[model samples]
Target: MEFFYFLLIGAISGWLAGQLWKGSGFGLIGNIVAGIIGGIFGGWLASKLGIGGGGLLWQIVIAAGGAWILLFIISLFKK
Candidate 1:
């Protein structure tokens, strides 16, 4: 299903973002949440900026970028 693919991409993106961002993700659930939200943000950003996010790899890349940014913003507020 489309939802499953989205979740899969989100999980991978979140995990990768957490790993790259010094492991700040809450846990599996947190990562999933972050990734899913990040995917939305990324898709929105891509659309607004006229960037292509058509393929699975592109979606992952965009989601990861968005997740990293989201983590960075959260850390800033938490500190």
Candidate 2:
């Protein structure tokens, strides 16, 4: 269903972000959480900035961007 698809996207997005940023992964579950949260942040950012992407692929792109930013912030704090 749509809900499940969103969760899948979140997991993938988080995993991708973690891979992109070395040593920022928090395992599978944590990644999922971060991605889901990041998705929201990304969507909001896109909306505020008047940017948009259509379809599922676009959603993943937006989420990945957000997840990466989130991980980057987390890494800064961890340091």
Candidate 3:
């Protein structure tokens, strides 16, 4: 189903973002949650930046970028 595919990509994006930004992952459920929310944030941000596209690869890139931004913000508040 489309929903399942979305979740799958979200999870992968989150995990990838975590690994790239922090050298670790937030576990399965955490990754899924972060990915989905990040995907939403990423899409909004991309639209604002005049970036638009389709396909699984683009989705992952956007989601991961969003997740990285989210993580960076969180780290800032943690300090």
Candidate 4:
């Protein structure tokens, strides 16, 4: 189903972002949430910028980028 795919993508993206960003990522649940939200943000941003997001790989890349951005913002607020 599409929902399952979304979740899968989100989980992978979140995990990857956490690893790349060198942050805790708020654990599995938080990572999932962040990734899902990141996916939406990335998709929207890409659309708004008139850029093609490509396929799954590109989706993951965008999602990870968005997730890292979210984490950075959160960290800034936490500090």
Best by lDDT: 2
Segments of candidate 3 deviating more than 4 angstroms: none
Any residue pairs clashing in model 3, and if so which? none
For each candidate, what TM-score against the reference? Answer: 0.88, 0.88, 0.86, 0.89
Give the winner by TM-score.
4
Between candidates 2 and 3, the one scoring higher on lDDT is 2
Residues 1-79, model 4: lDDT tens digits: 9999998998898888777766677787888788888878877887888986578999898888888888778779978
- Ten-residue region with minimum lDDT total, candidate 1: 23-32
Candidate 4 residue pairs that clash: none
Q: Which window of ten consecutive residues has the lowest lDDT sum in model 4?
A: 17-26
In candidate 2, which residue ranges exceed 4 Å CA deviation? none
Instruction: Please provide, for model 2 over 1-71, each residue's C-alpha lDDT reduced to its tens digit, 9 standing for 90 to 100.
Output: 97898888898898888777775577777778889989989999999998988888889989989998998
Clashes of each: 0, 0, 0, 0
Question: Candidate 1, residues 12-78: lDDT per residue as tens digits?
Answer: 9998888888766667777777888898898889889999757888899999888888888887998
Write the residue-wise lDDT of candidate 3 on 1-79 in tens digits.
9889878878888888888876864666776677888888998999999897898899899999888888777778868
CA lDDT of every candidate: 0.84, 0.86, 0.82, 0.83
The 10-residue segment of model 2 with minimum total lDDT is 19-28
